[model samples]
Target: MLSKIQNTFILIVDDTPKNIQLLGTVLKNVGYKIIVASNGIQALGILEKIKPDLILLDVMMPDLDGYETCKRIKESEKLKNIPVIFLTAKTQPEDIVKGFDLGAVDYIVKPFNSSELLARVKTHLELKFNQELLQTLLNFQRDMVLMTDGEKVIAANYSFLKFANCKNVEDFNLKYDHIMDLLEFEVKVEKNDVSKLLRLPKEEEFKVKMKRDNGEYLIFRIKQNVIPEKEVSILSLVDITQLENQKSSLEEKASIDELTKVYNRTKFQQLFKNILEENQVNPKSLCLVIFDIDHFKKINDTYGHNKGDDVLVNIASFIKSQIRMSDILCRWGGEEFTLLLVGSNIEDGVKICEKIRVQVQNHPFIQDRQVTVSMGITHYLPNDNLETFVARADNALYLAKRTGRNRTERN
Candidate 1:
């Protein structure tokens, strides 16, 4: 939430230079952006150029009076929404009524107290902010908003009525008193104690997930604002479903290798670590196999990097087809890959690796070239951590390469 005074712009339109200086100094010292205009005509010209959040207009001016200037402003389509406050020397009730009738939201006497000026400015600014915020939410068509006075619903936006399938607030109340009761909220609340939940201390914000009429799921961030003086609570449900979906899509893309479309080393490490922790309690049979293309560098040097990449992609797809859905495959590094065989013992792991090695030997990766792989197989040990376990498999791979290329070794 941004502070009310931050980024607030006020236009001071007065004939007196001393009054303008005093008001500008007071507002600027409190962190407000101020634009000064000497008379009402100049102020209206400035309004045509820059729209300020609030305006302070003097009732007496040379060419155009404050009342006429304010009238012209209220007639304009773009500038009518700006809140205008009149600075007048008159103290009669008719003068105040005339200012209000001419569209001035408030009036301040010429010799005004600084504290009262500050308070009125702050109040009107916040009121404008709230009104604009609600209008914006309605315009975007993504937020469902409603106001309640603890027990009864006072008002609701069109989006809320549409969601509830009602014509108006009265129609909505006939079916549901609390907005929380209209949907299946993910957060659990007491059955008959909704007021306690609505009156959350300090107006806490939370999230809820619900399915829409079109069978799609939507997530909303609920924000509650309580007005202690009015005893009203404004509840806003901001739609964040698209943002959450995009975040998950980004995370999925991050975990996958770009070339082979298989899980990358980082994702593989996370999955294996979780499995190792779970195995300590359940003790399931698990196997880890590390394999790499034999003479991969020579193949890349002789053919091309493009052909090498194609071979890697084809090999990954074939291996994925041969493995079970429960198994995990990841691209460990350049020309190297890992396979985690869940619920498979050492013997079954070695047999699977041998089959893959023989199949690669027979399969022609290119028109006239043969590609092969050597694998090292190892199963989980009760006392092994991730580092020690991977190191053992890597040592076995070194042994297999040392003895002969295209063979599987168990360690």
Candidate 2:
């Protein structure tokens, strides 16, 4: 979210110290770095040296009046776009109109409100910030903005290597066509639509996927615009893989038991939603395993609570190590842990739970010297809902507890 901002500087021009001091204090507080000029001539000298982002010019002044200073500023080609606002004692509508006719963006009559002054400054600052941001995005890394000619990439920004997943920019210098046919894009890609974009030369974003050199599919938001003075289309592609991964990671964190770092009850419900959404197309076999450490409360009583926490961490780590990356593991409160295996059926899911239980029972705690686990496992039914899936797993977990501790049960 960090961005570049041009015109971060503000110049305050006034003959009176009182007015300058008041405006200078307010603008600086709101994060606009300030430059002060005591008179109109002093302001012109500073303007010649450094073109400020915005200038607050006072109408009444000795030597050159505000009108002459503003007229001189307008006459210069380089300083024309740099906005000028009038600060004046004259509240007459005609005076305000004259200030505009001389090329002022807005005017403040006499005393300015802290909120109103800040509001105007903040708005312009943000506008400049966005423009600078667009500039940065265009030429970031090898992710260059390119203007293409028909089927081939004609030219690109500094960020050229990323789109094609190439190692170096030299590979992109050559013309490339049949890119859409080669990349295996899920959605239709139209190079012709880029011509329609020429009418309005603003960035337009559309969702697209890129096939990496390693055959990995990466999500991207592609932005296209027409380049001024050049008969070409500008293309900017931003990778969104990190955003998607972060969203999944946060969702997992939200449902986890903090102390044990395992999925809590909240994660169980969310996992169901994820499975069902994907189940509409893919033949995903959903599996859940619930495990609780044996005699955990008594262990807390024998050792200090710290030791009991250590025992839980050990068990969770043991279970976590045996699982595949496609599985979800979370602390389901207290000494309990839950695993959601993405594609494992009942038999495979049961085997996974048994392996974890035996691993916990056989491995002595490096600290406590003794600890064990009992587990219950279940597979998702074709018609199973959230409560039903979990209830079946819980039943098996209870059955494991009934048939002596430190064992696994599945149905």
Model 1 clash number: 0
Clashing pairs in 2: 142-159, 142-160, 143-159, 144-157, 144-159, 144-160, 262-330, 262-331, 263-330, 263-331
Against the true structure, candidate 1 reaches a TM-score of 0.55
lDDT of 2 by residue, 84-145 (tens): 88998899999999999998878887788989887776666566556556546656644546
Q: Each candidate's root-mean-square deviation in Å? A: 14.0, 18.0
Query: Could you tell me the C-alpha RMSD of candidate 1 in Å?
Result: 14.0
Instruction: Point out the worst 10-residue segment of candidate 1 by lDDT.
Output: 276-285
Local distance difference test, each candidate:
0.85, 0.74
User: Model 2: what TM-score?
Assistant: 0.48
lDDT of 2 at 125: 56
**Residue-level lDDT tens digits of model 1 in 229-317:** 78787878888889989999899898999999999999999888887666542334788899999999988999999999999999998
Tell me how far the alpha carbon of residue 90 in candidate 2 is from the true structure, in angstroms, after superposition.
70
